[model samples]
Target chain A: MSEVDVVRSSSMADEHVIEQAPQSGTGELDALAAALRDGQPSAVEGIYDEYGGLVYTIALRFLDSPERAEELVQEVFLAMWERRASFDPMRGTLKSWLCTMVRSRALDMLRADRRRPRPAYSLDSADGDRPAMEIPDPSRASDPAAVVETRAVLSALDILPDDQRETIELMYLAGLSHSELSGVLGIPLGTVKGRVRLAFAKLRQHLGIHLEVES
Target chain B: MTTCAEWEEEYLESLAAGSGPSLEVLAHMESCPQCHLLLQKDRQIHDALKEGVRVVPPPAALKSRVLSSIQTSPSAPQLHVMTEGSSPARSSRQLHRGSILIARLAAAAVILLASGISAVNLARSSSVTNAAVALQLPGEPVTYGIVQVHPASGIAYLANASLPAPTPIEGHASEYELWYIPSGGVPIPKGALVEGPDGQWHGAVRYPVQGSGLIAITVEPAPGTMKPTSLPIAAARV
Candidate 1:
């Protein structure tokens, strides 16, 4: 079946919510961005207070090191401060732009670590000291909507078949390129791409109306 | 010509994969409102997926550290100073002060160079023929020993460290081995390692490692295997 045909066959988009593009900020975020352009130290604190957790979270998930994640957060904010003039509020929201910056830096860090050979998951050699993945407390999130979105996203992930979920997470969260995903999963490149498409389809199905809702 | 539906799927996939749209797709989005709406819908998916990753608040000190760094940095935006002009007389006075500052900076650089030379001489006394590169261990910081690779001597020296000795698997003896990993090439086993005096590990291996290669310590069921059996305990670039 054609790709659109398949999408239509699922009957998922019938209930899809059409989310509006996050409008450029005219208020606090704009002032913060303007202040950052002028190298205002207070502006650094403002942006950090708003997005520090999200930046740190992406780094931690990709690198799995608290120290490295913290360092990356600092680096991202500093880069944003230095390149504040490049930010165009008309193109996208500050939050989306910041997320892109975090992903770029995190992916660069991962590549610098080199292509890892798959570790032997032997019982005797497994690292027992590895830290558990941190779970966010909605109560502590920046807003109530964030809490609901977090819960909803997590629920969507839980419903995915194991293989598809693993591939999707490695591709998106771990910052693995399609080529890297092929090598890591020991699957052909076509298969890796297929798995990703299938995973996204399922996410669209499960997250239909919820995905459309702006947090 | 590709259908809008196909272009939309490709656009959504690229964004969710943390990549921007291609030039052709961007052109299409610009002229087509339907495609532009598709782009917004893609953003929604991207944002939703991002939330699936758990958030960990950064260390409380990080904010202050960033602020202090930008405040003191030489290249930090002088936008305020440039935007608010001063009188020509005041500017001339500032220019005079800048000259004095440049002279002082030159003197400081000379002193720093002298200190660096002395440190290099001190390192030369030991077999460490080159500057030491610290290996980054994931998870907790290295608590016990430090790992450094000396390219000049073709040796990786492990100082009094706390790496756990390998445990033998059933019917096979296991040992930690060192390998030279070249950029974009298979790993070449350097040699088998034995704990040296004071629980250190050192070895001279015969691998022609490139400038951008890595030295890794891996556990193997037996030495001389072409491939490693376990993940590296530590690794540093040459």
Candidate 2:
């Protein structure tokens, strides 16, 4: 069966924001790559159908405009198809690679657009320019327990000390590297790293994971 | 680079920063099971955060536009070429029509780089009649063809035997779109090309593209798009 056909026949659920499986299984990605190499038109639709929301979410988190986010989504997937030959499954999962690509490209777009840097706010910005903080509906989780667990995790994140929370948002959601965070936040690299460590420890404690937080 | 206890803090900090691990940490983790498990746990948390964010569906117009762009782009078989080679772009500074230089450069042959052609210094002789460069698609022998440009006229002509018929967009025809990608600027669409039976597409631009500009071609859905939906099949700096 064609890759598109197999995707259609599979039991993969479309509604959940928190995917149970890693984004785009290796098998599915392999098939998509092959289809792209063969010039199959269906691959484009198939990929978008599968990961379009995730791509859009990442873009929206970074760019802050649904219109610009939409444009990045289109550009990213098209670039994926164009650069299909460059994808290496052994190196990483397709989803992670896609996220990294989207982040880099969005950052590039942001740099190109170069708006005035808004004054840093202690709370989430009033301009609606904060990186993503809204949580997906917990009910969208696969099971009732999963839903509750998901809510707990988000609540844990929400209640984190403001500094730690901001650090997390800047690093993960804004796709900032350590050096970039230091420069942007006007904090020392060590301080930025310390904040992230404290944030992760708090998150793990809230989620009930027993992982150690090294001092 | 530091003791295990110190490395542990450094490792978690790096992960939180979205930069995975440094080589020193990587080497250390390979030898230490505890560090490996910590790395795994860190990664799991990172993945959850990434996946748990709210989902936003793309606007209705995006999917059809993306589909239309991909359908009309160059066939994928051409990209099967290995991405290792000395970039033809490095030598492109000498590109000229009937220049005989392409042959000598092709023989100088240190290495072959991957896909994406870079065009440099493409010009017509003193006559200023026709300034053209070659478009290189991915292939073992490097599929290439002539691209004619009139910087003053803001017109470009593409003639390549390897060029395929434009892929048709849903509910619309297809056309080849030429774009000039300026350094540090977003790609600006020059105009659309209508393929003749002989497999050539040409168009006039709204503005002049200056020297050493990058050019690219993508087959886009018709009622031609203001932005490109597919990656350029060919990219060259001219």
Candidate 3:
């Protein structure tokens, strides 16, 4: 199921969605998550098949080596399996949670290697050298909803004001917080917040999802 | 009073910060679908952006590596870290014992447990072993340690180590490696032992050690080696 569909099921249509678990991409993700929580071996295979490319792309772009990236992917999934009980789908989508895990562990790995020079780049993030939107991701070909969601995000990001876009990239891609972005971009924290809010608002509009909070 | 608008503004800031919604915002969100939807869309956008990344298919070996890792590497050997269960500190004389006593008494007990007939023949074999064994430096032993073999995994953990921590010397040999040497035969490399906070070695070997050989430890290079280049500093036959 596409991220857009996940968004709609969990947040768009129902006001009571907050009280229930956030559903993602048919009940398959939910089933996978339940299996994972129960420490089933099949869950690892399912999760890897679904999210391995995403994990590898993020790890590869950060670690800059295919071997280390591969190791990191293995580490991430194994860790997720070991600590499956901690995962709560009510908190967020599995993809985003895995993104967070990949980023965190990759950064930890980089930090632990004191002999190596500190990475001045994001640990796990989207491949930035190419316009990812333009590239048709073969992995997501089976799920058109995912494809459209990817395109919409990239397209919305393209239309954002340069300042706002830069702010979001620093915060999201660089894994910087509001204060860090403010410090890096030489702006006040409020300005950092302003740019993110404006960028996200415009993104929501462009992606055809509007909420009262955005106003 | 914090208005819903104020709570909503904080909620947006927290989401953009990549921090999850605060309890205040969550409480607000429980009553506010608008803010909840905002959170959902924000997450969807992030995931979508990540999905847009160029898919670099991982190496085919990664599947085997991940799967075999679970099969081979058990959870950290927390329960096996110490064997003595309060084995008293040995005096210097005991540390210098001229001979190795295999767990013969325990083996005899094991035999006697099978009724009186089996105990006599098994006492002299020196083949029966127990969970705990002493690893000692040969010939008027200096510092000694204990090796606790977890029967299920054959992974050893050190206890009451009077031996100094394995030092990284000459930038080549950094860790203490465990080896299993059969009687009058070549030493098979087990794996490196990691030093715990208490300065004793802690590690598990993936090898299927049968306890039919002498388990020995030698300081070797970091990440360990296939064979030992130096004589073992401490030896114990299980």
Candidate 4:
């Protein structure tokens, strides 16, 4: 047909080969990370193929909107490319770091959305002066068994009492520190510490995990 | 001795973050198998959660968008220069509005003075006689609409169409400092401008022109003082 169509056809052929290649390995992620650090163009495709689903899922979890989640996924990768130089291998694995980045971006988007006009008072404003309150979404709580199992580690948090669960979700999922949570939840400092401790203990029990306490 | 509960919380946080404890904590855990077992379980849980998390691919168009944005965006040096004067600042009003026009007129004046025959006395009497010649700061690209310098007047203008607005420096009695950084040179302090009660400010500084450079702004304690303790609010090159 035309030159544009020719180029598109060629690219489609190339993508077909890439898609057919094994897509479930960490090797691809490590390679993509290396390529991105080295500023290679092909790394973008590799990264998208490997991590797009995870990033999109995390964004969808927080925003609950496909369009917004898609937009954020793009923004997250764009940021990754822009700030690739700052990626430190020593800090943690690239995947963990990427997860942290995606989560932070999603949380930021959530906060911005809360600031926009809404019919009801935002949970954020209600808990602004208190330690953060975790409002469990019944829908997410009642997810399919597979989805629950997939997120089973998080379910250990469900073993916690409501107050402890509130503290743990605020600290873990929302990335708030103890002091900030105290402010948002309007709880005494001691109470916050107690709840966090109890929550960790319950999580440890539910997950059959043990934590070494340092003297 | 660290309490079981206190250490437990820290351990959980560390595992969630995929980081090991300090050497001291590690040594303790080594001597205490009970704690070591706990740490192992935590790691297992963390790993499982990580595996369960799905990896999402970036959109098909992201690569092109990122590549094009980087290519079309002005170079960093130019951006740095532009941010200096681009703030909706009122203090540098004179400098921002007519910096280029002044530079052109000054260059023309310098040329006429250099040609010499008829206007030596006229040039000598001109107030703009000591105008500084704009020097391109080191490490800056020679890009147009990025930085303009007028040495005679000791003014550097930056084109900052892309820089974001400075966060509102709320409250009373606050000052912001501007620095002119030459290539490979230390930042030279340009004086301070005050922000009004409405958290708005506008002004320019008259510092001894050291070299052609980028402009940087930092918020500081009041009275238009010299040294800057806070991070720069905005920056641009001239």
The number of the candidate with the highest DockQ is 2
**Candidate 3, B1-238: lDDT as tens digits:** 2565455557666765557778867887777776666666766776665454334555543454454334324442222211221223332332233012123322322333233221111111332122323333335345534433333334333444455655654544356766655544555655555544456544433334454545556665455544454455555434
Decreasing TM-score order of the candidates: 2, 1, 3, 4
lDDT of each residue in A1-215, candidate 1, tens digit only: 11111011111111111222233355987888778766676787777777776566666555555545555676677678778778877665566567778767777877887733221111122235432333346788687676676566655765666567666655554455666666555678767766766666676677778757762
What overall lDDT goes with each candidate model?
0.52, 0.52, 0.52, 0.44
User: Which sections of candidate 3 miss by over 4 Å?
Assistant: A1-24, A114-215, B1-52, B73-238
Local lDDT at B108 for model 2: 19
Shift in Å, residue B129, candidate 2 = 39
DockQ, candidate no. 3: 0.12
Clashing residue pairs, backbone N/CA/C < 3 A, model 2: B83-B114, B85-B112, B85-B113, B86-B111, B86-B112, B86-B113, B119-B236, B119-B237
List the candidates' TM-scores in order.
Answer: 0.37, 0.40, 0.35, 0.33
Report the poorest 10 consecutive residues by lDDT, candidate 3 chain B.
B116-125
lDDT of 2 by residue, A69-186 (tens): 6557766876888787787766554555577677678778778778422212212533555433444455665654444444455556666776676567556544556666665556
Docking class of 2: incorrect
lDDT of 4 by residue, B1-238 (tens): 4765566556655554446666766666657767766666555554534443322333343333333223222221111122243333324543443333323433332343343321121111211111111222224332111222234434432222122223334343444455654545555555443222333333233334544444555543343323333444344333
In candidate 3, which residue pairs get closer than 3 Å at backbone N, Cα or C atoms, i.e. clash? Answer: none
List the RMSD of every prediction in angstroms. 22.1, 17.3, 19.7, 20.7
Model 1 ranges off by over 4 Å: A1-26, A115-132, A135-197, A200-215, B1-53, B77-238
Per model, kept true contacts as a fraction are: 0.28, 0.30, 0.29, 0.18
